[model samples]
Target: MLYKLNLEHILFLDIETVPQKQHFTELDEDVQALWEQKTQYQRKDEFTPEEFYDRAGIWAEFGKIVCISVGYFAPKGDQRNFRVTSFYGEEIKILKDFKQLLADHFSQAKHLLCAHNGKEFDFPYIARRMVINGINLPYKLDLFGKKPWEVPHLDTMELWKFGDYKHFTSLKLLALVLGIPSPKEDMDGSMVKDVFYIENDLDRIVTYCELDVVTTAQVFLKMRNEELLADDEIKKV
Candidate 1:
């Protein structure tokens, strides 16, 4: 079934996010209390809400997207070129640009959004962020009443699960196991917050996000029993 789908119809993507504020104290008193209550189970007694604040980006309510890198296959005759681009900078701007891309190009019913663990993370994160920012949800991201099969989104992690819902696979680990080049050579998701807030390096995060997108596309191709994209075939625009 995966093989039958057109590769060109899929938009592969990855995102980098950071906490809404540089420090937990920066949040208003009310929101800070909310954060503490929200992460109680995960933090337990090991870490205070402030200590666990670095990971706040994992939750849409407390975080904001910094970058969204997308890659799509464009085949010309026998040649395949994977074009990659990113929407970065301000959170609202990033969300608006991504929404525009979805509306302008990938709006058709046949178009699909593909990401590693996207169905669980990327897809919903983008949707929640858009709503929070007052940006209209694109058709691809708006899944209000669509049936499971009618939704046009693909997840590499979900595909690898193959119905074993208990299994969880990190994109870096999956890429390594699948023999595709790892996207975490420079940095992983754990370092994204520091990289963005402390170092103020949006370009670095964008590069990493784009690498993940390319790696995801490669993983999809591997699943389809097709050739993995060569480094030369990937172009970042």
Candidate 2:
């Protein structure tokens, strides 16, 4: 099925997020209490709200997307090339930019979005953030009355699950297991918050996010029994 899908129509993407503020203390008392309650089960009794605050980026309410990198395959002479681009810095501005990109180019019915664990994480997170930022939801991201089959989202993690929901796979582990290069060579998600806030290196985070998008495309190709892109074939544009 994936083999028949047009690579050009599939927009592969990944996002990087950080806690809305530089520190947990920056949040108001009400929001702080909410954050603590949200993670209570996971944190148990060992980690306090402040201690687990580094992970606030995973929650849409407590975080803001700092980067949304997208890639798609296109004809480059006689061969296909994958080009990557990113929107970063100033949360609302970047979110609006990304929304405009989708509206300007990828909004057709034939277009689809592909990401690893996107159905559970990336897709919803983006839609929720878009709403929070006052951006209209594009048809592809807005799942409101669309039938289950009508939602054109491709999740690599869900595809790999094959109906066995008992296990979950990280993109890095799946990439290594499937022979794709690890995109985490420089930094992982755990480092993204610090990279954005303390190190003040949004470019590094964007690069990391772009690499993940490329890796996701490669993983999807692998699932379809297709070839991965060569280093020469990947362009950051």
Candidate 3:
């Protein structure tokens, strides 16, 4: 019998992160001094660590979360509904809020959390920051120590390996390779941090995040041998 997944409980999520200013200078002064002299987008230029973050919007003053977008398959439907939420505050409060959302909706379900490179970036970044903030990690995020394939985790980038792992393809590039009409065709991750920092616009961040979740869900669908849905169907929620 084919396994029947509780689709509603599978949370496909992505988080946009810029380095934390507080942690930026933890490096040696020489490195820190060089880093500070340049913008994150400008590698050749020198920067003091502090100046780099100042221009890079790495401090909490630049707002903690630009966006938190999540997606899940709808029960009995061939579609995905994604919800994008924004968190703006100190990292501690934002982490608490993020933990609460998972606790409130997914605490008891057989939840499978999905992300692109979440194993290396999103998951650990959130966990370490949550600990630094004195907040207990949500149960769903406590599976870090387990072997990669043993946990209730799915990383779409890793999933692409089934097709021969043709080099490291970015989520956007993979979508195009699969003819999924790459979302975020207008913007990339580079602009996301700046959208939050310079424009201070939460809606753009939401849009960026929502695009990621939708793309991820599409990638997941393609992996499962299901027909891919259009952007309208994918973003219905």
Candidate 4:
């Protein structure tokens, strides 16, 4: 499937998210009860809602996007390289800037959005966050009545599934198996919340997010049987 993709038309991306509040106690009493109900079946008889609050960022309702890093291919004569950029700071601002970028540069019907596990995670998370922030959905993310075949989106992890529902792969694992550089050099998703809220290091998260975006693109290229980009080929703008 990747054989036919025009690298120029796809916007490769990854996002970082965190719970809206620093801790479960910060949420009001009513919402706390709701979180309990939300996680009861998953939590079972183990941890309480407060004990599991750190994982709230994985759910769109209780979380907000902290960063969204995107990459695209640039042609250099006979070669193609990737350039990355990020939208971050406040969640609302990040969503606004990212939305404007899509509206301005990649709004055409042929433009595609790609990410690892994006169909289940990044894409829906972004759309839900935007709606919660009262922001209008961008054309690419506003699924509406569009048929599955008509949606301009790609998922590398989904492709790797190969119709087997029992299999699952992480982006880092895919990078390792595909011989692409692992983007989890410094911090993984588990550390993102601490790095953002405690350390107050937005740059670290942005850099990490961009690396994942690049790694994801590289994984896609490898699957397409194309040469991976050299370090010198990656230009961040």
Assess every candidate by TM-score.
Answer: 0.98, 0.97, 0.73, 0.97
Output the TM-score of candidate 2: 0.97
TM for candidate 3 is: 0.73
- Ordered from best to worst TM-score, the candidate numbers read 1, 4, 2, 3
Error of 2 at 39 (Å): 1.4
Candidate 4 pairs with clashing backbones:
none
Point out where model 3 deviates above 4 Å.
1-4, 21-65, 76-90, 144-150, 163-166, 235-237
Error of 3 at 161 (Å): 2.1
After superposition, the stretches of candidate 2 with alpha carbons farther than 4 Å from their true spots are: none
Predicted candidate 2 versus true structure: per-residue lDDT over 87-203, tens digit per residue: 998889888888898888899999999999999999999999989988888888999999999999999999999999877999988999999877545898999998888899888
Candidate 1 per-residue lDDT over residues 33-111, each given as its tens digit: 9999999999999999999999999999999999999999987789999999999999899888888888889999999
In the range 148-232, model 4's lDDT, one tens digit per residue, is 8988899999989989877889999889988886644699999998998899999999999999999999988898898898888
| Global Cα lDDT for candidate 3 | 0.65
Q: Which scores greater on TM-score, model 3 or model 4?
A: 4
In candidate 3 the C-alpha lDDT for residue 133 amounts to: 66
Which prediction has more favorable TM-score, 1 or 3? 1
Q: List the residue pairs that clash in candidate 1.
A: none
lDDT for residue 76 in candidate 4, whole number 0-100: 92
**Candidate 4 Cα misplacement greater than 4 A, ranges:** none
